[model samples]
Target: MGQAIVVTSGKGGVGKTTTSANLGTALALLGHKVCMVDTDIGLRNLDVVMGLENRIVYDLVDVIEGRCRLEQALIKDKRFESLYLLPAAQTKDKDDVKPEQVKEIIGRIKQLFDFAIIDCPAGIEQGFRNAISGADRAIVVTTPEKSAVRDADRVIGKLHSEQIEEPKLVVNRIRPNMLKTGDMLSIDDICSVLQIDVIGIIPDDDYVIKASNNGEPIVINPQSKAALAYRNIARRILGDPVPLMSLEEKPGFVERIKKFFKLG
Candidate 1:
């Protein structure tokens, strides 16, 4: 059976959807048959992020309501042969689908895919519960801010209480310069507070925005540090011993030339 992993955050705007899209794409690139499920319901954006917005004829709700078959609701990715998307209903509210229904849907999909990556809704509400109901593992995305870390702590506790122990952590939007200047929290600080293993550290890169705006995930961009970070995360998910990328910025052409000539 495929592993159903939920990508969640206790707070919104922490790159949960972006992580889901990129990680699913990365996994598919690594030759895994991956299916991404958007459980955000009314505010569904995974379809847009994966550039399948125009292809979403049947959504998760339709599948659960028996309006369509699971295969009919799956939107196949044009870029990746093994990647598929099951989008949430944009017109329906979060309360429209119950937790058991989401679990049943995930259970059905697991039989056909190598991974079921669920993009969970923000906050620890019913939406959150529904997203995690069928998950074998959970990836909690957060920034290195106090509020984000605090919320992650709360969410981790909730996951543990619900028997989803040892949920992995992804520190998103990391600014190395800010960390060097002591302007932002370090990864160590966040990990120390959350007490969970850090699975990924995504750098703050403008390429992420450009890719998302173009309906492309940054993981496909070879030049993007954020992309490399997410790819590492994907490998880690597969139990690979990939080391985390160094958070320092690489020297520019001029700086490299100066260093080589010993003229600095």
Candidate 2:
């Protein structure tokens, strides 16, 4: 059976949703059968990020409420051979669905896909609980800021309380200049604070925002550093020995970042 992994952040605007989108896309690009679920309910944006919003007819609530079958809610992305999306209900609140119901849907999805990625909501309330219910593992996304790191720590503790032994960390939006100037938290700083294994370190790149706004994930383009970082994270998820990226914003960064990731 395949595994379900939840991409969560206790705080909002830390890139959990973005990370979820990229990871799923990267995995699919790597030839994995991937299913991404948006569990944010009323604030669903995974569809928009995946650029499949226009194709969504059935949603999570529709499947959970028996208004439609799970297959009906699963939107296949023809862009990838086996990438599918199960979007959250736009009109329903987080409380409309229970944890057990979410778990049931994900359990069935996991059997069909190589990986089931859960795009969790922003808070540690009913939505968050429901999101984690179906996950076999967790990827906690955070930023290089004091408030984001602090909230990530809380999330790690909460994950342990829920018996998720070790949730991996993805440090998003890393500004290399700020790190070099001691203005931002380093990877060591964040890892020491949270005590979790670092799975990804995404650079703060303008192209990533542009890709999201344009309804295409950056990973599809191998030219951007952020895309390379995300693809590295995906390789790691596949148990590949790709090295952690060195974010050096310089004159020849494109070539240097490729060498760091050992990509052709």
- Per-model TM-score versus the true fold: 0.98, 0.94
Candidate 1: tens digits of C-alpha lDDT, residues 156-221:
999999899889999999999999999999998998889999999999999998899889998999
lDDT of 2 at 219: 88
Candidate with best TM-score: 1
Error of 2 at 237 (Å): 1.0
Q: Stretches of candidate 1 above 4 Å error?
A: none
lDDT of 2 by residue, 122-149 (tens): 9899999999998989999999999999
RMSD values for the candidates in order, in angstroms, are: 1.2, 4.4
Instruction: Give per-residue lDDT, candidate 1, residue 195.
Output: 91
Candidate 1 lDDT trough over 10 residues, lowest sum: 255-264
Q: Using lDDT, give the best candidate's number.
A: 1
Candidate 2 overall lDDT versus native: 0.93
Cα lDDT for residue 85, candidate 1: 98
